[model samples]
Target: MGRKLWLTTSAAVLLWTGAAQAQDAATAQTDQQDEATTLGEVVVTAERRTSNLQETAVAATVLSGESLDDRGVFSLEQLQFVAPSTTVQNYGQGNFFNVRGIGKSEATTAIGVGVTTYRDGVPVFPGYFQTEPYYDIGGVELLRGPQGTFAGTNATGGAVFITSRNPDFTGVNGYVMGQAGNYDNLKFQGAINLPISDTFAARFAFNSEQRSSFHDITGPYSGAPGDIDMNSVRASFLWMPTDALRVLLKVDYNSLDFGGYPADPALATNDPFEITANGPHSGKDETARVSLNVSYVLDNGITLRSITGYQDGISVFSTDLDGTSALNNTFYDRVEEEVWSQEFNIVSPDNQRLTWLVGAFWQQDKVTFPVTTFPEGAYHVGFPEGVLDYYIFGETPKETKAVFGQISYDISDRLQIQLGARWSESTSRNENVYTTYPAFGLTLLQNDEVTAEKTTGKLSLNYKVDDNNFLYGFVATGFKMGGLNAPNFYVPASSFGPEDVVDYEIGWKSTMFGGRVRTQVGAYYMTYEGFQVIVGDPAVPLFSSIVNVADETVLMGLEASAQARINDWTVDVGAALSKSELGEFYAADPRIARSGTCNAETGPASPNCLNLDGNTQGYAPEFTFNIGVQYDVHLPNGATLSPRMDYAHIAESWTSIFNNEALGDRLEARNLVNLLLSYKTDNWTLAGYVHNATDQTYIAAINAGLRYAGPPRQFGVNLTRTF
Candidate 1:
């Protein structure tokens, strides 16, 4: 099946490329009267400055605002299909992101997930608050591999950078958009840009959305419609006090409130009625950031830059996972984080020679997780007599300091080499306590601290095949620091170690048919050591422990993507395949020693299992593919018509880290179709769209004892006017 799909996709690409070539010839002749331009070049701030994507020499995916608008994408979760070897999952209320099949599960204070997120070059949100708000974003950049040199720490797998829209100084502009559709849904969004002076400007934006639930609560409980409300406002000012100095100040705020269903228990014999009703969940996130950047142009053709930033945020969620009739029977979790960082770099200005960037970075963050389980009396009914009632309260504080540098020198016109390295030291302090609970035999109740330091490096070589084509190969090493874990039923103490990976990749990027078609292909081999795994500890009663399972993993994969414009229509297709395996394990801890040797063959729940270590790496799909096509037609009445279709497929996957058993393994593949019809004039535009046209029913997430279903079909029409 995989081979056949690949062949079909290849044939489609060839046909589209041939057709695009033919249209390019005609378009060239028409350009004599009016100039025609291709897609706008993408510029990203991944290296602290705006640089063209093609010259960055990194495996990155750039999504433009126009492209996002055309696809009707409004949130970060919808961007999963745009990048290869990437997946997003929802664990309860928090969102988990994975790159190259490496990510964490329910535990937040662990070294498992190696990904990090940044907003406008500032790190605000911590690992506990991964489900961040997405609003007023100008564009998003996804760096596929490690970004240790430029992105500071915690970017072992990769990094995601979001750039919001800044104030415009050109003129006064604003737009309003509204949508109404089935399921009693309504949405409104508006943005305005104002210019105060030639050097100062500001922009403001806001959005609100509400919808009714699709699931029916037929039992005793009553279910209501789910709703989402989000508001964002931002202002930016550019000040120039001297000829060689420029200061830009930006301030933004965002808030999100969502009431939705909770995770459902596992199905019994395929019975759909076992699912629970949509619950009442509410969450709010607010962030404030300030950045100061200064640049100096020296007389000797050298440029020096300094960037400093500070960020603080608070996130809270109040949810009722179990729709019980008892009052205050809910679960609430809140996280507050503050981060500060600074960097200074120097680069030599030259067109065709050596370019270097050296900088030092320091960052510190403090995150507190206070969880309160209401109506604690109900939880102690099953316990022994005289047991005290209590809840979980934990706080984690982390500090990191690092210095990194990168240098790129052209050995010759056809050959170029780049080298980068970073040295980092980090420390974590964990304080956890159970208040109002009995101290006797309470399992885990203590404070834990861990610290680690490491140095990583990367090397890359690129060879130019021609003006429009290049071949590159690279070897990079990345690491994630170890951390302390909160006391729980399964773990008496934190049992984690630093996770590291060495990746080797070779790829080619080419533009063919007079820049009408673009293609990229890559192959990679990755070796990981000290892989983190979640294990149930028998000594700690009911709690589970996060530890570095004594096992190695080898991953090999191939990825290919192509885009072509055939006349007025455009098409994009991509696919990836990977094979991962776990190596032999040696007994290290006493628990494994008591259970015989680590190589023993055992059942899914056995503690001595070793050969199936790969299964414990949750949410890693072996095969994935995405196909999309869009067509646009210009009408005679100065209107336009566009239709788009996108389909994503994933092979059966193991939902749990232990791979004990597969849930929703044979479920139906996701097929989503979207339609848009729009009419545009000089200053006004109107459009209508039908999202999830099929109204397909599928599980968005499935775990050992829980399942989460996706949203139903929705249709809405929107109108926009610019002044």
Candidate 2:
């Protein structure tokens, strides 16, 4: 099946490349045709400074707001189909975005996520808050590989920048959209723009959606699961006090309720989506954020900017743990997180040989678990006698300060050199008390603090071979701070050290066929040290722990992407090939250590250990590719007709560090296809779409001895009206 799919995709690519056509002078003169070219120039504003994407050294997959809506890519999970080398896996409590075999794969907060996600200009949301949908956005930029100088610490994997639609000083304008789909789904998303005054403009957007349960709960479940109820509202105001000064403020809120992801005993079931577990099942997330951005341009053409952001998020989850209607197997957890951040920047004017940008950042956040009433962020099982860690009440406070800068100097008309660096310091304090089951053992920690400091840097050179071709290469370093774990009864209180990574890459960008075809290709190699991973503790066997494998892990990959436009056809093809190898390391197998070992209260240093020298990283697919095609046709009645198709595939991956297939830890490769048809006029558009047209059933995640199924096939129609 995989081979056939690859061959089909290759043929499609060859069709466009081999048959590249040239348009007549009269046909090329039309603005409509020029705009239809999918390979048009785009300005990447999310970087340290605004620059043409085709001229930059970064490897990014950018999508406009219109393209996102047309492709029905509303969330990170769906985004993987359009962006190569990206992965999103939902683990019930939270989901994470992984890039190039890096990022967060564990469901714990003991260590920070490797990737940085920026909303507007603030890295305010990760984990559960990341599940929020996207709407009324300007664009999304997914930068692959380490972005140390750009994103600072905790960006070993990559960075994602999401910019929402901003209000313009124009007349009142906006668009409304309504959608209906299978599984009794209904959705409404729209936005309004208001020009309050000559100097001020405002934009308001909202989204409300709901869907029926996809799971057939045959067992004694207390609440519905595998359903969606999402609502969000956002308001943005842009104020220009003077021609040289601007101030923008944005406020956003979300109340998302995912009735919970219930799992069946995947080992005994053919249908991973159908479940028979019984317990109160609910997955609710509430988040609110405020961002204020102020900027001013000086007489010398330099710019000064300040960004301040605040966020508050609360998540509640409860579900069946064993997933087999077990007598005493359920989990209840609740967590609240709050963050405040500020950043200031000084950027020199663009189009200069000596361009530079300097910035400083500071952030503080607190994570709390309401133990008396809410059970959150942990798993425990019972056998009619006792359960491990009945009550865990804790507070984790963290703060970070950093200074970063980048400089670019043109050595000649065809060559440029760039250098960047960031100095970061972070502190984490854990104040918590842990209470065990049946025996009622207690572990307490009062204001224990750990500090981590790192200096990361990047160096690159860009050479312009000609007007339509560019070559670039760079080496960069990334860092992620470690933190103390919550104390458990059987294991000693421990803390992991920070992890570091160094990445090397080279790339080429080119345009051909009179700007109709644009292509980018890159290859990267990364070495990781003191890699952090989450696993069951050998001491308690059921409790989770964070550990660092000090060996030097290696990762290497190659990526290629091309966008083309011919006549009325638009096509995009992207593929990534990668290999990852874990360094030599030995540890007790958590699943079996309880039954054998010298010391029952030791970890990694026990007499008997499992050799995990060459295991593959979890969720790191060996290959991924995406192909999209669309064509437009003019109608006789002054309307336009369009049809689009998208295909994507993810190679097989493992779910655990052990990589044991017999233990049900391997995830099979998956192929997804989507179809869309649309009719458009000047003021309105109507479209029909079938997402996941193949309806392939695949394991999306594995945690706590359970597996989750990805979303099933969804067919829907959408109507949009513009004022």
Candidate 3:
């Protein structure tokens, strides 16, 4: 099936090329007039300095505002399909992200993150909060590989940077959109810019959407609509005090309410869009953030910037864990987090022989997490009917401080060498307490404090072959500070050390055929130490623990992407191939340990261990790729028509670290295709789209012994007006 799909896609590309060539010859003059409208130059700030993406040495992907709208991407979940080397998996509680085969999938509250997500230059808390919706944005940049020099914290994998549209002081402008789709979906969005004075401007944007559930529930308890309700707003104020100075203040808020997991108990016998869960199930998430940014140009042609940000968020959910009508198991979990951060940076003038940037960052994060479980009915099978509720409460406070600097030296005019380093210190204090209801007495209490410090750096050399081509090579190191684990039953370990990785890469970027075709190809190798993984505790079958597997792991991959403007058609193609090797390691789970050498109490085993030597990393597909094409047709009335198609495929991969076949941990490869058709006038746009046009049946995620199916085929229409 995979081979056939690839062949079909290739044939389509050939057909499109032939058609485009024929049209180009007939409209040669017209084509020349449109030649100036190729893919625009992509500018990125991955290294704390603004530079053309093709000129940067780092491996990264940039999605412009137009691309985001064309793909109908509003969340990180949709972004996974747009980038071949990145994967975002939902684990019930929230989404887990991975880039280049390095990341964690568990939804733990107090653990450190591998990939850091930032909004407008400010880092956000823990991984789950990274799921916020994307709207009124300028661009989304995904920096692959390690980004430790400037990112400073929890950047072993990479980073995602989101840029919001800024307020315009020249005039007033805005747009409004209304959308209706299948499944009783309705959405509205609007944004407006107001010029308050000669030097100050304000912009406000908002979105409200609601959709009925796609799953049909059939169980003992009342069924649910599985609806999706979300509202978000953002306000920005920009002040230009002088020609060399500017200040910006922005505040954003979002609220989301949804039916619980759209999942089935077992993948083997359940329908793709049917669930048989019982009891009340739902979830809500609220978030608010305020940020201030000031930038001033020095007399020496340098720039100094300062950013201050504060965020407060809370997420609460209740679900039927067992996914059955029987009241056997249910749970309620809540996470409240607060973060405050400040950063200062000094950037040297661009195009200079010696370009440098220095920065200092400080952040404080506090989180309160708690979970309660209820047991009832014959769900326990022979247990007493009157079972007490169990509760777990935890509080984690963390602080981080760092200083980093990077310098790039131009050797002659064709070769440049860049070097950077960062020193970071972090402290974590955590407390966990467990108790059972009815008695309201504590069963256990645990506390731990940990402090860690690390120094990381980057070195790169880039060579410009010509105006349209460049070759680069670089080596970078990334780090993630580790901390204590929640004190649950039979957990003997209290703390873990930081996880780190070193990455090496070489790549080429080029634009050929007179700017008609642009391509980027790269190869990378990464060596990881102290890989963090979540697994069932050896001493307790039901409890989970996060531990750093004591072994050296290696990952290597190849990435290629191309964009072409052939006549009236635009084509984008990307492919990624990667492999991971987890070194031989002992299993902490006693149940998986070998015979008599395992210790029963601590389960630390005396030489007896279960080796997972040759397993692939969880959710890391060996091969993934995407292809998209869109064509523009001019109408006699001076309007324009566009039709587009996109296809993405994910190769087979394991969802479980252990690759446990007995538990059905393997997921099969799947393919999806989307279609879009739109008509545009000078001030209005009307569009319709079909997502998952083939109604592909695939497992989107597997966690806590359940499988979640991807959304089925659905179609929608949107109308927009610009003022």
Best by lDDT: 2
lDDT of 2 by residue, 301-328 (tens): 9999999999999888887777876655
Model 1 — TM-score against the truth?
0.87
Worst-scoring 10-residue span by lDDT in model 1: 376-385
Candidate 1 residues 479-553, lDDT tens each? 887776555543356547888888898887766555555666777888878766555443442444555646677
lDDT of every model, 2 decimals: 0.63, 0.81, 0.77
Candidate 3 has its poorest 10 consecutive residues by lDDT at 376-385
Model 3: per-residue Cα lDDT over 1-723, one tens digit each: 356345534644554455445544434445555465456677898677788888888778888877888876788877778787888776444677888867666666556777788898889876556657888888999988899897876888888899888898768899999999999999999899999999999999998999888788887543343688989999999999798999999999999877666565644566857776665566677899999999999999899999999999887665666666655466666777899999999999996899999999999998876453332110111111235455556677889999999999999799999999999999998766433333435366667788999999899999999887789999999988887776654555467667889999998887654556667778899998887777555455555567776778898887777787866788988778788888766564432434433222234434434566767888888878888899999897779899999898888888766777666678778788989999999999999999999999888877666677777888999999988
> Candidate 1: global Cα-lDDT?
0.63
Give candidate 1's root-mean-square deviation (CA, Å): 4.6
State TM-scores per candidate: 0.87, 0.93, 0.91
Compare the candidates by TM-score and give the number of the best one. Answer: 2
10 residues in a row with least lDDT, candidate 2: 595-604
